[model samples]
Target chain A: MSTTLNPGERPTGYLPEGADINRNIAARRLRGKIWQALFFSSLVIGLLALGTLLYTIIDDSFGYIAVQTKIDPEELSDRPLAELSKEELIEILRANISAGLFRRFDRDEPFSERSKESVLQLIEERVIGREVVASFKLTESLLERERIEATVRERFPRARLEFHSWLNRDFLTRPMSSVPILAGVGNAILGSLWVIAITMILAVPIGILGGVYLEEYASDTWYYRLIETNINNLAGVPSIIYGILGLAVFVRALEPLTSGAAFGVTDSNGRTILSAGLTMALLVLPLMIINAREAIRAVPQSIRQASYGLGATKWQTVWHHVLPNALPGILTGTILSMSRAMGETAPLIVVGASTFVVFFPDSVFDKFTVIPIQIYNWTSQPGSQFRNIAAAAIIVLLVTLLLLNATAILLRNRFKRSY
Target chain B: MTVAELSAVDMAQANGRYAVELHNTHIYYGSFRAVKDVSLQIERQRITAFIGPSGCGKSTVLRAINRMNDLIPGSRLEGRILFHGKNIYDPDVDPVEVRRRIGMVFQKPNPFPKSIYDNIMFGPRINGWRGTKAQADELVERALRGAAIWDEVKDKLHQPGTALSGGQQQRLCIARALAVQPEVILMDEPCSALDPISTLKIEELMLELRRNYTIIIVTHNMQQASRVSDYTAFFLMDADRAGQLVEYGPTEQIFTSPNDKRTEDYISGRFG
Candidate 1:
């Protein structure tokens, strides 16, 4: 509060109040430096946390594994198993297993229709009976190669040690199996796709229109206030609660509708993709509505005034001016909501995602299991190799999320407005 | 001048002589009366300037003409505003239709964040004026030309309206209002946000529009009122703070001759 205007005539380092101005400046600079350092450290902490998460997942994704087989593969064939023709592999599979099992395999899917890779997989499963007895992390495999070789030679003389990438093509294409090596995330991937598609279809329009009604059409009545309060509270409710609600409403109470019985496809019970999708839709609906409201609210009031001044009715004003301007923000909200739905496990679990689904869901009412649930299932298993496959599934989920977000971001940018 | 002074002859020919007439109109926001018991007649195809100090309810009265005040919560209007000898406030008359026939340009340039072509097309499209491609193009051209901005924006019709300069944007808003083929255009200080050059341009444009459209402008500048307006209504806040008309007559007489002492003082820059 010094009002002295002739401070320049005084000593250069001192203020009119006889305080050392340079010291004051230095102290302020020191405080700024300390705060900057604190901010930088916080950023580093966040980055380190993210790095550790990705590292652990990737560390378990690829490494060396010791495999022991019931029979020696060299004794059965001179060439590698992968190079075998479909007919040869099918013959080998037919010769090793029981005739009843062979006939069952043909009943499930004809041998002539099976590809070479699938037949080789079957022969390796039914005949060679490969078992992963020991696995090592990527860092351990890289640093302790000689020790891993020695351990394999001393303890499992018949076991072969080879570098393996758990996230291989076969892992992405095959269905779930008790054997970790044979398990793939194909069914889970498709289930996630189906559930997310249904979630979007069920949630997006309802969320957006609900926002419009609240922002544009609804008056400040007590009932509307109550609805608004409930929506805000619903956004904070646990996802598991939405799961229970979906279970009661879509799975049990409306089983006739959700299980496809009402549509004349009566094979499935209530635990279906539709129920899981509905649960996820409920879980994200509040967030969607909140985000849409924010986007719509961000549109300047003058734009609405301008539109109304042009003789546009309320509906026309909302449709032509408000919605188009709010589109980019709504799309951003969808991206965030979609990412949350993709990674969510608790709600889908309570809504009845099968822990181990082998078949792809062919309809909305078919039994399904998403990738996060699959990861949870794999991580909870007793075998060490299951962790490796879980890591691979995590990678798949992350990539799918990135691709989905990229598409949404591109759409948001396309419709972006300056005002 | 008081409403009772020398108005019998004007009231006799009110319907045929005036494009719009206010019969003791009172505007309110909630319980607060903003404009009180104001009466005036606006001649057809003439520019009528409403000059007053800030917050004297000039803008509110302007908005009340086309029912624009209905957008604000708790705002109500009493009495009647007549257009073409009919009370526009009649229950059966839709506000949307009222706004279509009497368009408005705001104090700030509020062009939509769209192409200039689309900005003009918005009014007609919302009113369900569908036309062929060529016809639509012609309409856009006519509206832009009518606002005197077609030549500057001809090559850039597809550009965003917001990309125009402040003055061009105001002109574009005028074009947007003109596209609906409104009978009257209410301008709420259309030149206030512009530079001097842009203000001159809009004044000239307003004078040009007087030939085909009835224009009502709310301005704070006395020179603008005297220069562009055919008739001027000077308003002042009463002791109760409700805005009331102090004088209404030809712009020249309101500026040069004496009427109410308040109008003379305001014109002479003594006080608001």
Candidate 2:
């Protein structure tokens, strides 16, 4: 407000002189740069953490392994064991193992019914008793291949060094086992599907209906406001708390319903797929309701007015106009919630999902274990082989999540209409 | 004689004389009164225009005719808005039925994100229209034709109504209202959002529609009211900021020889 002039002629917004102005501009520029750098660094840090996670998972998923056998295959066959015919392999397996063991294999799946590859696998598993003596990560396998081969040859002459990808067809198809090489995520994958299906079945309709009621029908009164506030708060509550609630309600109180006892079936208890799904449903219900509410709220008020002006009833307006306009957004939110339910582990564990389920859940009443729980179990085992399998399972979970998110994106874009 | 003077005689000869009559109506949002006591009769099958400045409650009054204000929370109306000699505000009278019979076109074109055909059919479908496919198509065509937008949209009837230009979308919305066979059409600044050409088009369409349906339009433009309306109502906000009707008469007299000083002042652009 200063100027070198008479008071009557003084300017209202006078500039400070050049040097001070330049300094101020420079200081502002420097401050802007600092904030920009800080924001960029935060982004870099987040990306670096995600990059490290992916690198470790990939590193553990493939590598080299040294396997040793108790009985040499050369001693059991004249030629290479891999070159032996299925009959020769079976004969060698019969001659080496005990009579009762061979009889048990026959009784389980008669030799005539078994495939050649199955017979060879049985022979390698039972007769040869191949065991992984050492394992190396993907990076170490490539960088120190010669050293690994030398160490394997020097330590165990019968050991065979080979490159192995933990995420193989066999690992995906075989049932879970105590033996690391024989373990697979097949059963866990099935359990995850069943649990998620039931979760969606229970949560989706209820969550959407609740959202519609809140957004469209309910009056803006203290109680409805209270309900809205509690729903918002419930979405942020810890998932494990939901698990405890599910345990008390679905597992203990509604045990008969969840255990299939109400339907005249009673072989299993309440710690079944239905119970796990119900728990996961409880964990994701708040999220679903919040997202659905947001989607429904995004529908323009003008559309509702237009529908009502056409002499449509409240239900007709919501069902025909509001719902169709909100569908894409609702589907996107639902799928995102489904992905969240797919990856949740704490709630399922508290609801009693088994850590080592070998059998697939064929019904809602059967026992279940999801992929994340399987990874958790594997990572805790005292072996690098288990770590590799855990990494593979993590890859599966990531792929599933990615696919679900992709579907959400596709549905949104495909149905997105400009108004 | 001018068309306005001729219609005045036709208005006298009509059996019912009026399509709608408002008896000392006052509109309120919550406790705040938006429109003060006002009463007027709308001649059957004629276009009536409400001209006023912004926030003068002209649109509010127009919406009250069809009970569109019911959608707004805490909005209430006092006195009676009569249609077919029955007060529409009666508890036994369903707001939905009133809306179906007295349709509205909004200030901005708000066509649903649906095909042109579907947009027109929505009103009919919701009203339990039980027609064959061919009959449905005929109904759509008649409604579109009634809005004077049939040719522009007939080729692309399956295209989304929202994909049309602003003016076309507005016409589509009018067509949608017509599909329900409403006896009255309420236009709340329908041409305010359109270009001059589109505004002229809508004005012409309103004149055509007046042959079969009673029309009430709220507009800020005085010329538009004088051009299209058989009867014109002028409103101005009072010291309390509540809108009150300043004058109601034939459009020609209201413009040329207004009885109220405020109407003359407003028409002469002295002040709002």
Candidate 3:
């Protein structure tokens, strides 16, 4: 250190002169600015990547497509299907399709008594027999209209070139179809809801109870310590491993119980909604327990002491004070684990989530297909025609995830406000 | 009191004037003996103070009274603590019942993170109070008034108890202990976390509470003990790091003419 002082005088807290100080300050500021720029660029890059992903998903969901029908819907019906009477549409359906297809429709729900919406749906389902031969993005459909018309004329000479967004209202309501244009996420949505519902029912109470026992009741014995260590380690295990375990335990070992055979429904094997849900529950159980234990442990020890000092029994203290305080945290963990379970694929695939089921799940014993499995099935197909439907399915999965997360956040905020 | 009479409680009159008697009690946490051979009587409707430096087992002995020590893992006690005349540690005797009759306030103001009304009502509610809403309201008001914090918190009864100031929260905790109408109340350094004004306020509140409840306090502040307690017990950490009672007497006599050199040294601020 240097100071401007007389030679004989002792220097105190010596400092550099102005020019050198300015140089040092300038260098420090330059370093800070460089770090700031680096960090800001990293954030922008991350946001850009997310933006690109979201853009791709949305781009694939909506757009115009050229559809060719076996019998022109216009030639089959005089007016728009929406405006046609149900009986009129039924007459057109009777005139157009083969007798066997017509009989199948009637068997499912008789066309004679079908409502206007049902008839419209029926015409879309079988009478028109529309298959999207060519698809275009929103930008391409808007900009290259002449080119699209030319291609339709050359490829499917009788096909109508009309604007069609693949992710329209009907896309959410229709069942699975071998034809990409006819397929919808209705069955997948219902299946996912069932699987998640069953997973929640099985995992939440059991996981939370385990957390409470481990954190509050269990003695610090070697057995309990072993259990704690195993639980923490189990959270890191692969999802496919859980699937294999589920196959062994719920499928093979407890086949009678999981297959609905015990309930006298012998048609379904062990690969049912119940089995898939149980597998998903097993996949997320370790996550649920770890999160719940952390939440419970976060409650101040003094609060427990306060309850005990007030003459509350151990269970009373846990129920009245501890649980209420830790609920938000528990729910947050559940939300994270549930979302993870919803997005998981390998485990469900291993546990036999159907890829081509046409029917929505009517019972827990029914074969099911969740959104992730459906998306995987669509994306893995050789034909590029399934891309639009796959994208639509992906959007559905993302929105469902967003909705669940939003609800969890809302509940957590409400709890935070109260406490 | 006879053994049979001790088991029986007169709800209207409370228990005998001698609220608790510790007979050669030793407290241990895991193999370490924290407090050794402590014998004392905490009188009913009076304030008793246990005064000593840190690590002297004052809090340990205080926790021994209500079996609060039982919650600490590996914590055990030898000998006995008798409430009225019955040993609280009896095999069939329930610790929950002992805590009900004897409430406690901790060192820090640890009001439950709930509404002020709920904080006060919790003890009563958990104990299976099936009283009407009006009765519950009256109990809340009476308890809050007993702690001398009713006027400040009456308008915001639904507000979280933690929102109150340090002094107000401490009083709220005291009100919570009072809500169950416990016959005896134990305080473990109730004012160490408070400012001088709050400390003085708590000291005065303790004096008032002594009229209706048996109060035992463990304090590090020598002046606080002299100011608030009717009886004083001084403890010192022995050679083995176990706490032993050095002197016990009327507060006035103990403060003026302390019998032990360690007690006098402690009072004179010579060494801990």
Candidate 4:
């Protein structure tokens, strides 16, 4: 410990007996600068890590792919497959493929009722299916275009070669395919939409209501404390546990209800969109409640006092003042939770989300496969081309999550400015 | 004028001159008593001030009058607070209804997070005012006028109530309290957070509000009490640190002539 006296200068009592006051102050300032630098570097490191993740996903999505086809498209058709009109494509498929297959297509969906792009896609899938044999990253595809073309020509003379981006407009609308090049994320996107919609619908109202009960209505009893403690603990529980619970309860015991067989939906069993949605709802319920409670707690006590002083009942005070003020924070938490639910793969997988559904979910009872499941399925395949498509699926997931977060940020800011 | 002097203990013999009467009231938080044996009469249509040092529970007693203490968890009130010859603490008597008849202004200005118009209309709307748009507008104007903040905020009625300056916000709170047309308004150190100019404005407004609303204010400012209040109650903390009233009388008599030496010393700035 240092005790000191200074003449005509500010007395820094902590200064050492013979230490120069200015030097000590300077040393502390230097230490502060070092701490500041360390903090700033940590921020940069975080940003760098995030950038690397996004870059890796994006780089895999676009590239050169050397594709091999079983039969030459020119030999079967009058022109290139890409040059044919949608009607011509459909006509060729109808004439070429077996009657049984054509009948199956009709049973699934009428070709005449399908749009031009869909008809073209069907022709490409059923008739002129292409196989992706080799793929290259974005940088190689861009910088070594001539070399890539030369290598493709030398390697497989009969195979078609072109610059291909795994991510395209067709990716959003096309159904799952065994052939990686022909695969699209349409079914997975639709399934993700269905499950997320159901999850949010089931989670938000119930979570917020539960929060209101805990924060406003419930007294400090042992029961209240127990429930509060359990909810707080549940937020940190690994999501896969919820998946097991959902499988047991929603998929097995309540199979009839979950599968909508009670509603006479005989096509799907217990492994349906409803079960996955319910599972996700259970997964996010604690998170949503915790966030809502925090938002509600952030409301000033004086505001509640003001409302009470004005003769408003508890419900009135909560509805008009507390909830409105807490709404922005609540929405931010809900959006983040929704993003978590969107990215969740393990829970849906356990709850029996299909990994290879060709059709979009028509109802909550329909078998479903969300985007993460699609990516998981694709990445597990031995084909390097499948990894490319998986990366593309990751891009889709990221974009959707980003859009959701952007909307949340916009909504929060709007509320913040007003309140 | 000493400690061992005659105590003019007038226990709630208030017939009708007082708008509110507390008889042997003790305020407790959970199991801890905050104020003990507080018995006082707040006169009708006049400003009565509860003046005391810090932690003396002047605010607690004021909050008890409108049952605002009910908002606190585990808070209990002993004895009776009579409003218009009715025991407000009766189980059948809803605290919300009591608060409706007797509104409150907080120490810090707490206007609702709403437009100025909505802030004033919150009470009336909740009280079930089915009126035309023009009528709602007129009511907002009238309330704002009553708080003497109409001219400054008339054109900015659509703005957020929180955007107002500290003084304007306090006035806005007063306007909000006045909107429901309550018979009494309890102010808890309403000017303590304000500048001297704003304090003067609130004090002057209190005098103007005395014609209709029975106003009881809790303040640490002795000069404010001497200037605005008709009746003054001096509360002192007892051995248990529980606040109890030591003197209650006309403001002039209590501020100038001594009833208790303690009150005299407090008035002379010798001690609080």
The number of clashing residue pairs in each candidate reads 0, 0, 0, 0
True contacts kept of 1: 0.69
| Residue-level lDDT tens digits of model 3 in A243-309 | 9988888878888999999999978889888998899898788888888999899888899999999
Q: What is the C-alpha lDDT profile of model 4 across A7-62, one tens digit per residue? A: 56775567454558778888999999999999999999999999999888878988
Model 1's chain B yields a TM-score of 0.94
List ranges where model 2 is wrong by over 4 Å: A1-13, A16-33, B1-14
Positional deviation of residue B80's Cα in model 1 after best superposition, in angstroms: 1.1
Please state every model's RMSD to the true fold in angstroms.
5.0, 4.5, 4.5, 6.0
Q: What is the interface RMSD of candidate 2, in Å?
A: 0.6
What would you estimate as the lDDT of candidate 1?
0.90
Where is the poorest 10-residue window by lDDT in model 4 chain B?
B1-10
Candidate 2's TM-score: 0.94
Residue A126: error of model 3 in Å? 6.3
Candidate 1 residue B200 C-alpha distance from true site, Å? 1.3
Off by over 4 Å in 3: A1-41, A70-129, A142-160, A417-419, B1-17, B130-134
Interface DockQ of each model: 0.69, 0.77, 0.53, 0.56
Taking all chains together, each candidate's TM-score versus the true structure is 0.91, 0.94, 0.89, 0.90
Name the TM-score of candidate 3.
0.89
Clashing pairs in 3: none
